[model samples]
Target: MSRQSIVTAGVLDAALVLLFAAIGRLSHGETLAGLGVTAWPFLGGLIIGWLLLRAWRHPLSVVWTGLGIWIATVAGGLLLRLAGGQGVQLSFAIVTTIVLGIFLLGWRAIAALVRRTSRKRMPAPV
Candidate 1:
């Protein structure tokens, strides 16, 4: 992939992580301060998103990408729980993964739609 595409993917991943954190905090009736300290969750989301993008043949395949990300995030969380001394909050991790997947995949879907529309609008060579 081109450097620009890589940068865009990173931006999308970061946005998804932020969105997941925001939603999690709101749902739990917690403050942003609490989220700030728990950076692992968001980092996990970022890693999952990046992996999904890397695994997919095309960035436009949002559904598959999202599914991949969801699977990876949950599995990663579980592994982390098993490997780490502390217990992992399964529910919280699952919810965060789902939210992050949706945001990242949703952006990809929108980008695909925009590209398709633009292609259709372009003038053909005479």
Candidate 2:
């Protein structure tokens, strides 16, 4: 992938993680002022995921990159939160896994679908 595409994927992943934090905070009546506190663990996990997977090489691969990112973001985030004295309730972990799976992998799946459709529509070389 191009450098821009790699950067875009990283940024998008980070933004989605931040959005998840914001949504959770808002739902629980928490102030946005503490959003960084909520988001940092997951964001750190996201970075770890990307680096471990060398995701930039196949940034849009749902199975290869996205799956790893989802797993790492959840697992790593939980560990970090636990270490930081944050709540790690079973229910919260379940919700986090489900939500982050969708948030992190959903976009790549959609992108793959769109790319497949576009390729089908493109004229083949004679």
Candidate 3:
């Protein structure tokens, strides 16, 4: 809702993306350069997740945002594969995307819960 929230989400999303890519590369015995290719899906996930959250009005919107972004990333990778390319690594990419999405969205959810609890603890204006 606020600009700060949006910015925070973006930063978290990007960091998760990088983290996921690094882990993926390490797992596959590949170099960190794999991070470059992973960035596309990461960026896509970030944008999509942020936008969806921005428009979200329900308490569970964060969960939907995370799942949606994970789906989007996987779908993007699948499209790339279908387009006659070497394609992104399916296992690593999808797993990493899901994990990162959860982390990012989970952070938002926790923050929202904290804010809500705090508001409830405060006295209402007369």
Backbone clashes in each candidate structure, one number apiece? 0, 0, 0
Residue 26 displacement in candidate 1 (angstroms): 3.2
Where is the poorest 10-residue window by lDDT in model 1? 36-45
Give the lDDT of residue 70 in candidate 2.
99
Over 2-92, each residue of candidate 3 has an lDDT whose tens digit, in order, gives 6666556666666766776677678779988657775665566456645655534332356666566556555654454346354556675
lDDT of 3 at 107: 70
TM-score of 3: 0.66
Candidate 2, position 48, lDDT: 95
lDDT (10s digit) by residue, model 1, range 21-111: 6666677788877664344544564486557568434444566765666566556644654565535576766665566566767787788
Candidate 2 residue-wise lDDT, 60-81, digit = tens: 9999899999999999999999
- Which pairs in model 3 have colliding backbones? none
- Candidate lDDT scores, in order, read 0.62, 0.95, 0.62
Name the top lDDT candidate.
2
**Model 2 reaches what TM-score against the true structure?**
0.98
Off by over 4 Å in 3: 48-60, 81-84, 87-94
